[model samples]
Target: MIESDQNTVITKINRSWSVLSSNPIEFKAINGEINPDDNSYHFAIPVVFSESEPMAAVALEISKSHAVNLSVAMYGLDASDLSEDEIIDVCCEMCNVFSANVCNSFSGKNEGNINVPNKLSSEVFRYIFKGSNLERYYQAENEHGRVVIYMFDPCNYYN
Candidate 1:
């Protein structure tokens, strides 16, 4: 995780929103000017952050954005049953969900947008990082009405 500026954290979501609206795919990479692929990308998220801990902050954000607590959501994510392309498409759905949510959620406040939050809470991310395999993932048909993503780990392998 990268170091986070206190002031920027609040603005971070908004910045991500602007970037997504303007360029959904590349915004995350260039916004923070990070390497775009690696552990650091974890730090790109701004929500559910810790006061002085970048790693914890990022972890929290990922857990929230990914809705790790929604593990039940992955109930149907079995890789054996899906083709590689289907899995990739799933991941894209997840990305788009998060991306658009961030943008539409905070579209006006400028306080770091993430509009797709349906009763989102920080407690949502408070879980252990149980590495996921295809069979373990599931999708929740949140009111957002978007498809869930089961991607090829784009955050870890950019380009």
Candidate 2:
């Protein structure tokens, strides 16, 4: 069990992006519950960590408000003119970067390998992490817009 405050976790997450890429991404926790039913944002990038038993996973989803700006910061190109594939690639990188920071918060963390990111069109996340109780959900926003991150352990849903 990692004994850190949630704000500290958020700080680590924000720092991770800066350390990983030239563009440092700043995120602040959104002050509300995530309406699981909200499907306004359809696409997502899922990153899985499998270094130990009962694996862990993280997912990143960008909000419409910052979609274009984030895409630009992520790829160093104009989001106003990028293709679908480019956006997916950026989102994948975001998930990977965020996952590493998350792993650092765990007690028995190792150099976990991230599974290939999945680009989904619906609410498949509930099915993916069906019974995870050791889960953390964060909705954050930057100058561009909002990004949501979810961290969960597969084997500890009920515990």
Candidate 3:
């Protein structure tokens, strides 16, 4: 994709996050590589760009504490008694929402379908990140923790 297209996609991704979070969230495109924190939760979902043709995958890496904080903020849930699985589920739901938002933004471009979100091990996320061409890498931070969003093109596993 060209630079303008990349910017449009990044802007849409940022807007999607802003729409999702009750708290302020600002996403900036990163200039270099990023190492996912060991305590972070990772996820990816496949998106079909044009009627059964898979084009990309969107991934997220967010710290554990941030996941809990986001769950509370987004769902008004009590985080005090939340389990790890519950937190992961919330993150997965957020990923699903994000993917849907992105797909809608590109609706004119035949981007319509998004598959189920999958919780990924850090190792698996890293492996995919290394092998794929990253179309965008964006990071946003709040008082809770950090979140990184990855948009990869020519999705290897999906395509």
Candidate 4:
């Protein structure tokens, strides 16, 4: 069963995904699911938002395959037909939307910005959770395999 808090984050993440994409994606909170091998995702995009200093921050990681699927769905394009640059653009839009949604959940304002999206080696995903104390990790499967969403506070306490 999903824990209460984890369920909340999962709902938010799924809602973000749905609202951002023209296609609907239902994400369940899969408690205790293992993080897939780092090599599994060829690209990782991290979107971070902070309300202020030291209170709380939210970060999201999206796998390349999932991002591509999302882009294809949102744009009504064939995934196999998209160029690499187009896929990257879609991923950045997903990051922007997801980051704005998560940030608004904390700030009550619908405005948020993304840092330039990074196409990082798999190793970068490993360090994402390092400083987080309160974290909720969720897993969902689409045709592309498993997509993971992580929500956490970077400090020992979250306001």
Number of the predicted model whose lDDT against the real structure is largest:
3
Better of 3 and 4 by lDDT: 3
How accurate locally, in lDDT, is each candidate?
0.27, 0.58, 0.75, 0.54
* Cα misplacement distance, residue 24 of candidate 1 (Å): 24
Candidate 3 Cα errors over 4 Å, as ranges: 1-22, 50-55, 104-109
Question: By TM-score, who's the top model here?
Answer: 3
Rank the models by TM-score, top first. 3, 2, 4, 1
List model 1 lDDT by residue over 41-68, tens digit each: 1212233222332211112122222322
| TM value for model 3 | 0.78
Candidate 2 residue pairs in backbone clash: 133-157
The segments of candidate 4 whose C-alpha lies over 4 angstroms from its true place after superposition are 1-12, 19-23, 40-52, 55-64, 104-116, 130-134, 155-159
- What TM-scores do the predictions have? 0.25, 0.67, 0.78, 0.61
Total clashes in model 1, counting residue pairs 3 or more apart in sequence or in different chains? 21
**Per-residue lDDT of model 3, residues 15-127, tens digit only:** 76766666667777677777767578999998777755557888888878778877777667788877778888889988887676455443235646778999998788877
Q: What is the descending lDDT order?
A: 3, 2, 4, 1
Q: What number of backbone clashes does candidate 3 have, counting pairs of residues 3 or more apart or in separate chains? A: 0
RMSD, one per candidate, in order: 15.9, 4.6, 3.3, 5.6
Tens digits of per-residue lDDT, candidate 2, 1-159, equal 433556787888877656544544666655445644344243333333453366666666666545555567666876578887776676666676777666555445555555666665544655554556336666655564566777665533212
